[model samples]
Target: MTIFLALVVGGLFGFVLDRIGVTNPSIMGRMHALMNLAVMKTILLAIGVGSILMFGGQMVGLVDVGHMSVKTAYIGVFVGGLLLGTGWAVSGYCPGTGLSSAAGGRRDALYFIAGGLLGAAAYMVTYPSVKAMGLLEKIGGGKVTIGTVPGSGYDGLTGLPGDVLGIVLGLVFVVVAFALPERPRKGEPVPVAAE
Candidate 1:
């Protein structure tokens, strides 16, 4: 049942991603170039809505606090994030978008997936050495959230109440997403592939 639910949810998510034109590498490239804001706006809106729902549910005891997990901050995490961003900008696909694009029949996306798997395999092969170097060690002693939630187990970086902070941030994101211009900047050349 859990696997079935996962497949259903994953399929729906991929469908939505494809419908939003994110499956197109050119659209993603234009977003990185700052010539288009559609992808950024879409991402921000999704984040805003997700944050509101998750935090609000937690506050109301609808969300299972016991099931929530936060990754501990560490130097390797920052390095990994930088690498991931670089890959996303260069390939125009993050893991989720890459899979969605592949499912949509993009050949380049298949290559991206292959490269990602190779990277992951390399990481696995080097895991022992990486762990010995202390790269896997958690920094700051423990896991943390950006805001305080009374029973969430994560120590908050900020003193603000978690749900309140989440809602405020979510609203800000939503506002910024709405304020962003949807049209490409004047004089920017549209890619032939995107058309």
Candidate 2:
């Protein structure tokens, strides 16, 4: 049942991604170039709403706080994030978008997928060596949250209530998403039309 639900959800998500034009590498390129902000606005809105729902549900006991998993912060994680961001900008596809693009019949996304797989394999092969570099050493009190969440086992960096903080941050994202212009005001680039 869980697998079935996941498939259904994944299908819906892919449909949404395609409908929003994220499956197009050109649209993604324009976004990275700071010429278009439709994708950025959508992303912020999604994150805002999701954060609000998750934290609100947790506060109301509708969601299980115990189900939350936090990864330990390490230097390697930051470095990996930078690499991932660079790859996304260059290839115009993050993991989710690459999969969605391929599923939507974009041949170029297949190359992106292949490259990602190769990168992952390389990481696996070098795991031992990477670990030896001390990049995996935990930082920021390891696995701590930004604010204390009631019933969560992890420590927090601040005494602020996590649920409230989450809701506030979510609202801020929502506001910023609405505030962003779809195109840069100065020297506007050609508009991205649907393919």
Candidate 3:
């Protein structure tokens, strides 16, 4: 039942991605180049709203903290994030977008997916050596949060309430999304919307 629900939710999410034109690599490229900001705004808005709902739900006892899984901080995580950012900029598709694009009949996204699978395989092959190099060593206390939440077992780096902090950050993201312009400059050519 859980798997079925996940499939349904994932399919809906992918449909939303396609509708938003994120399945188009050109749209993603323009986003990275700062020639188009609709994607960025949409992403920011989604994150902001999601954060608010999640944290607020937790505070109201509607959401359980047990469902949260925070990855332990390590050097490798940061390195991987940099690599992912570079890949997104170069390929114009991140993992989720790549999958959605492929579903939407994009040939380029299939290539991106293949490359990602190869990269993952390479990582698996090198995992033993990478671990030996201490890149996976936990830092700043494993599985720590930025702020404390009542009833949550994870350690917090600060005394502030996690729910409050989350809501504040969400509000900030929402404001920034609204404040951002379509193009950085007035004279720049308007990017062609894929849909």
Candidate 4:
């Protein structure tokens, strides 16, 4: 049921992305140029809310902190995140969002889609080799998350009580977002609906 609901919600979001014509490179480019903070704003809100809810659940013991925790080691994770960030900055879209945009008649998005597909295929083709040869063996205890408390024994770095911090960050995000200037490109019709 949870998985089903997630799929349904994800589909709705994709539909919304499509309807807003966010699949266009120009739209994304223009957004990066200053007329939009849709991606950042959306992500930060999700993170902020998610952090608050997770901590709240844990504090009230509604969720199990032990069974639902993750390990945190940052080497591969940091590298992977760096790569993802680089890709997004270069192409102006993440994989899922890029797919949505390509569907909206953006030609560059096609290349992006192709590149992603090829990358996936290559990974699939190499998975056996990666595992059989133990390529990722060095990434010990790979399932890390912020909540995944480890042997450090909560020496003040525990983020569980950080819901207030998340809320404060969220509020700051909202305020700073409002202060940003919006400038539309020359010759393109302004997105009146977005205002």
**Residue-pair clashes per candidate, as listed?**
0, 0, 0, 3
Best by lDDT: 2
Q: On TM-score, who's better, 1 or 2?
A: 2
For model 3 the local lDDT of residue 49 reads 97
Off by over 4 Å in 1: 140-142, 183-185, 188-195
Instruction: Compute the lDDT of residue 134 as modeled in candidate 4.
Output: 49
Over 1-195, each residue of candidate 3 has an lDDT whose tens digit, in order, gives 999999999988988999888888888888888888899999999899988998999999999978777779999889989999999989989999999889888898899999999999999999999999999999888888888767778888788998899889899889999999988755667545557
lDDT of each: 0.87, 0.90, 0.88, 0.61
Candidate 2: lDDT of 9?
A: 93
The full ranking of all candidates by lDDT, starting with the best, is 2, 3, 1, 4
- What's the distance in Å from true for residue 99, model 3? 1.2
Stretch of 10 with least lDDT, candidate 1: 186-195
Residue lDDT tens for model 2, 78-186 = 9999999899889999999999899888899999999999999999999999999999999998898889888889888898998898889999999999999988754
For residue 60, model 3's alpha carbon misses the true position, in angstroms, by 1.3
**Candidate 2 — worst ten consecutive residues by lDDT sum?**
185-194
**Model 4 pairs in collision:** 23-101, 70-148, 71-144
- Worst lDDT run of 10 residues, candidate 4, spans 147-156
lDDT tens digits, residues 121-161, model 4? 99889878756764455444455333323332332243453
TM-scores, one per candidate: 0.88, 0.91, 0.91, 0.57
lDDT of 1 by residue, 16-65 (tens): 99998899988898898888888889999999998898888888889987
